[model samples]
Target: MSAAATTSQPRRPRSGNRRDEAARLAVLHAADDLLVEHGFGALTVEAIARRAGVAKQTIYRWWPSKVEILLDTLIEDSAKRIPVPADEPTAESVRGYLRGFARFLTRDPAGKVLLALLAEAQHDPDTARSLHERCLAPRRARERAMLTGATDAGEIAPTLGPDATMDALLGPIVYRALTGASIPRGLVDTLVDALLRPRAN
Candidate 1:
């Protein structure tokens, strides 16, 4: 009833969300380890909780579904290791960065994991949308910015727009991964050559 009384009430102690956060993180980490060892098809919600040292109720309380857990795991792992530079003065640096991205995709579990997730995303609208927003767009934007800077600096031809340049540069890698084709012997060199080639226009 009084201001002092209200102040002394201490706001009724705001409930901490730490338990939810802990559960969510535990699920993601469990998903990563399970997916790496047993593949997506073999992973289960209960198995994840067992591996994570948490309860099944905790995972469900936070994620609602196994797919959501996998998506969160992918996002957390990718965020920590995407090799895009904090600073690069030219398109070449961008190209090198993308090559590193490819290396990450191809090495260890990250590559196979991403491919599986991408395939799953194709059938799930929510997953697809989140993948595009959280993964593809930011990486593409970084590459585009670097290329645009290089073009402005006369390192690359001015006719090359961001999207087209990115396609010319990255399309090959995507083709390789998606189709299971070998990375062309001179992948980066070939892309750079195509990128730096004079536009007939």
Candidate 2:
């Protein structure tokens, strides 16, 4: 056989993966819509599949449960809106990040869904663990690093513990959300100020 005749043909392009990703995003969008419209109690794998116009098996093949689907949707939505700030001065980073975080908690859809998750966690240990591990833990780790940076820069008190500072900065925001109280417009600034100001000896 001639050498040219023996050459292999170019491989065909694959658009199947793009279709799959689109379907996956559709499922997530459906889940997010359901959470906002019907709350977590109304979200189910079957319902999401129906809403997304995909087979139930499709959702099951990717996510194990309704909560897992919801968690993924929540995380994806959050990443788009509340990205971690770039490295900068500690005071600026802390204040800006917290302000954005607090604003997210007070708005529609995201705030409502998060509050629903918190409520769900209270009764379901598995859900609680998943939320903490998948959602909360990563953000907490970042916050810890930010606090350590702030301390290293002398933007806050040297004596302040990073863990304690995290609690101080976040506790109020969570508390207000859980309690149905308004997150004051100035609460972010207030918290930042309180965080940066050293306690009098």
Candidate 3:
């Protein structure tokens, strides 16, 4: 998951007329905490509202469903954690992204929530669509842009397309994460070196 640089500050709610930043944050944080504590199967708008000490109507005003709430939280957390550096070479930038991604998967609560979302998405079309549009697509676009730039500059092999390159770079880490396996150290370096082989002079 690639992201533009963002600070750790909480972003304001984007969909509602209410301007109470505190209430918005409380809802988001409550939803995240409840999801982590109770799992997605048990998480609901009522539970979130109850935990946040806000009315259920307030949550509905800001977000249509629990999924949207979680999606919002995921977007905010991912931006802060998995930033793509602007000044580095493509190889270094890719390496940094992969490293941060690995940590996010292993150490962040949002990552666990993502796994839950993925599971829910399998049986629910709405979830699948929302996840693809809101969370996955934009990150894929950024990653593809970076890879395309590297390909154009002849830093990466012309034969390897951006989509395939992304699959190769992110596939193993995601697999390990899903399977609950530990990511071995230097794995990011190995992936970068192997996949981002320089074009022959």
Where in model 3 is the C-alpha error above 4 Å?
1-19, 86-88, 198-201
TM-scores of the models, in the order given = 0.73, 0.84, 0.84
Candidate lDDT (C-alpha), each: 0.68, 0.76, 0.80
The clash count of every prediction, one per candidate, is 0, 0, 0
Residue-level lDDT of model 1, residues 126-194, one tens digit each, is 868876886678867876777767777776773568888787777777667767676654787777767
Better by TM-score, candidate 2 or 1: 2
Query: Which portions of model 2 show Cα errors greater than 4 Å?
Result: 1-16
Clashing pairs in 1: none
- What candidate 1 gets wrong by more than 4 Å, as runs, is 1-26, 181-185, 196-201
Candidate with best lDDT? 3
Better of 1 and 3 by TM-score: 3
Ranking according to TM-score, highest score first: 2, 3, 1
Comparison by lDDT, 2 against 3, better one = 3
**C-alpha displacement of 20 in model 3, angstroms?**
2.0
Ranking by lDDT: 3, 2, 1
